[model samples]
Target: MKKPTLRLRLLRSFLVILTPLVLFLYYENYYAIKIVREEVSQSTSNVLSIHITQIDRTLDEITHYLLQQIVTSDTKSAYLDMASLPETNGNYTLAKIKIHNELTSGSTAFENFHSFFAYSVKKEDFIFSRSSFTDTNDLKEMLGEYVREKVKGQSFSDWIVLRYWEKSYLVRVAQASDGVYIGAVLLLEDLIRPLRGLDYGDRWEAILLDTTGQPLTKSVMSPETMTAVNRKLVTNPLAFQVFENPADHKDYLLVSTDFKQAPLRLAAMIPEKSLLQRLPFFQGVIYLIPLGVIVIFIFYSHYLRKMLFSPMNSLIMGMRRVVKGDMEIGLKEAETEELNFLITTFNHMVSQISHLKINVYEEMLKAQQSEFKHLQAQINPHFYLNSLNIINSLSTLGENDLIKKMTEHLADYFRFITRSHRDTITIDEEVRHIRNYLEIQMLRFPEKITYNIDLPEPFSRTMILPLMIQPFVENAVIHGMEEGSKPFHIEISAGNCQEDPNCLEILIRDNGVGFTPEVLSTFNQKKFGDGTGTHMGIWNVYRRMRMAFGYQAEVTFLLGEPNGAIVRLTIPAIGAFHEMEEEEDGKADDR
Candidate 1:
């Protein structure tokens, strides 16, 4: 079996030691940090709730005081009477003076009162308090614009906080019984007085936000810090949340609580550094543990690389050489038993592979030789049987002159076949053999058989396996002859094929009885029948050609013109002696 790779071994070792250590450290740190954050958030939330409640109560008092001033004032009835009278009436002037005195008295009665205005919708006139900073025209325009734009068309009275002259104010708008709009404005700083009095730490900041989440009091923070806080409020409004500030890359806990009596949110922001500083053990040991763990991991990794990775790198190099066909390579034994086992196994595998390759090569040669001898044996009996049959027919006729000529041709044909122990012969030699056999057949048939040989000189020297073409010629002569001497004509021709110039095409055709439908289908389907005469001859030729040239050889049978058979043989045009010489040269180089 193959041994585990060095990387796998090192990973196993590291996981056994490092996994639990890392998990323990992570859990411990997470639990401790979680406890600290929860305690801090809870404490901060409680304090911020108290401050928010105080601010809510203070605003409630302001709302009650504004409502009382509007309800108890006698100026409300006098202002309605003045708006009902004409501009020229003497009582209108006296009543307007009385209303202005009441407004001035109400504005000064409250602390941090900015201004108060009473608008008569029917008369298009505004009455201002003495404490108003702007002129009556500006106050009238401001009040008219506020009613038209901010209040829209609603007539209900409600308290709202707004910014005027770059300062926040708590404003209450009420419609008096006389159909006049009365507005009272107080500075927002006064409403948040209780929150300001609370003792938040130096690192903590308190803010009062209006209903729209805008800071009501003046902000002491930089623009970037305020922007970060505002972005957090957008996602988690009216809730306690913690986030990291982009400006300083430090964590801050934001505790936000909504005012129960007003549309306002109070927030307290405290830096996490200050909160963690209050913890007993977070300062010293929290940093040292991770640093020590990192140091240990570094030393452990270095030791593993020295003992494991270095040896594996050598083994990898040896494996690459083996892949490149150098099976003789072997790695030296490593210090560990597992590594030594891998090296020893690799060496033994290479040795066995070398032996198997040699055995496979020798077996391939033996199989080829055995097949060649078998094909050679198959050729002789078939040819000899036909020759003997011809001789027997001649003797029965008692035709000595014709028999003498047939015997000479038969001797010449067998002499050529026996002379060559090699598998291949030149096309010219094969054609000569076919001519000898045809001459013998012509003697037997006399004037009934006529033959023609057409061979191009260029294709005469092309190599082909022995006994390839003679079988087809023999078949045509024997089975294709007609009765009553109807002139059986056999034509043998060879040339280089036009489509593939490297290949030779030899055609043997006869002008005699053509193949029947059944026989033609058998040949076309390449299914040879099991018989001793013509069937075995054609099958032997087809098998030998395929074995010798592989895909380069083709044997086809067809009907010739004027009702006869055509046999075509296509094989590669390689010279016999030249191929033999090349093979000898390759063998010498190998040695």
Candidate 2:
């Protein structure tokens, strides 16, 4: 599967986390508003109910007192009903005093009770009890000018909204025995004045509504708003009202309760905005949560892309160039600390790899130069001249068979020398080349030179460096030859070493003059034993062995047991051509 980019991954994770947070904030806002609305409405309703109950109780008391004044303990007609009293009836003045005394005591009995009036419609007589907050002049003027005519036309016996001296009053009227009316007047403003100081909120209206949802007194709201509220209260009839006021384009909540003793409802109406104004600070936080999240998301995505995704994209691009072998590429330093560290490490790695390639190339050049030297050293023109001399002598003697044999051996020696440029030659072919070289020597020395070669048939396929054995053989012939009576003998044998089976052990024994101690020491030190540089070739072969088969490829020059020199050699196993085949495979991989 294809992988997602770093930006996509980080954004996906950010959304996964942010989605829940937004949802949670939205839910919290909804829940908080829901709870606050309920509590506010319920609390307003409860407060309204308390005030309404108290006002209802006061109205009940005034109503009962008015009814009591119209009847005696014996259920006879009351004083206000005596409209046609006789001139000799002294009870008339006493009755007026008694009525005034009863009205006075009743007016001061409870809060906002202004007057208790007893009026005789037949006699056109009126009486009132005045309190400190009441204006008796307004009442006397109302009695003389308005109440006399207003009561004469009012048909219902209930609470009436009456005006006196530009102020409204709640007048409760009760008829007693014939045309006598007993009534109580309450200052409408003072009756429900305490409700205005309620701790509901700023800019609320306290209203006393009749059963028909009509306002009985002045209120903060316009008549238009009141009409709409009254319509909802009458039609839908909820415990609370949710009304939008058209006059001010505001929403309001109306919490009201009915008065048990009167046809009125005491309501507290507050604007929706004002209602929430008193809410705790968390309510405002609930509204701001979504806005805060939006701001955070915008900045979060920007920084994440800038600090993380952009740098990661650069790093990925740099890696692609590196993979495609662009070692010259480089990345800019990142502002973020962790990404900067990664970029620095990548640059160092690329530098180290470039340096390693250079070192490897130099090593390969050295190996090729060494091989060229080996090729040059193998071509000995003097050996060819000597072989030609032997053949010429044989031909002069007219020995046709000996001349043919010498010419064939010399030709084989020249052929092997021409092919010395090859890195490796088969063990069997090398041994054959050695036989040709020895045969040429035997032809020159006749019976004075003799040699034997011993190599197992299974070891014939073992590959070794070209000219590896020939230089040592030439050393034995060149340095060990002596002018002696005994025929010079040389033997070459190879087998597995007793020390390590993974190695090859070879012994070359020659019954000829061996090396001196000085020559042996100089050869071990990789120096020419003679001033003529003859031993350098042997050292080159030894160095090549060490290169091909490591330091374990040992060559030791020892004095022979009785007369000759012994050349003991140990090398990494040449039992098969496995090592050469592996090297060729490695070269193929490089290509």
Models 1 onward score TM values of 0.57, 0.51
**Which segments of candidate 2 are over 4 A away from where they belong?**
1-5, 74-81, 86-90, 131-157, 160-168, 291-307, 317-327, 332-591
Candidate 2: Cα lDDT at 559: 86
lDDT tens per residue, model 2, 1-591: 999876788778988998898888778777887788878877787787887778888888888777777666522333632555642467666666677787887677888667877667667666777744347666656654544575667654667666665477777877665656667878777878888878766678888877677777787777788887877777777778677777888778877777776666776678777777777676778767778877988999889878887888888988898888787867888889999999999888888877887898799879766765654464355346546777887778787877788788777766766644446666677678678777767766678888999999867777777666766776788778898767888898888888788887778899888878987776566574432354566666676677667777878888897878888878887444566656755765776
How well does candidate 1 match the true structure, expressed as C-alpha RMSD?
Answer: 11.7
Judged by TM-score, which candidate is best? 1
Q: Write the per-residue lDDT of candidate 1 for residues 442-468, one digit (tens) a residue.
A: 777768788889987876766677788
Question: Model 1 misses residue 394 by how many Å?
Answer: 2.6
Can you tell me which runs of candidate 1 are displaced by over 4 Å? Answer: 1-35, 47-205, 209-216, 220-239, 242-265, 269-350, 356-360, 363-367, 418-420, 497-501, 524-526, 529-534, 575-577, 581-591
Clashing pairs in 2: none
Q: Count the backbone clashes (under 3 Å) in each candidate.
A: 0, 0
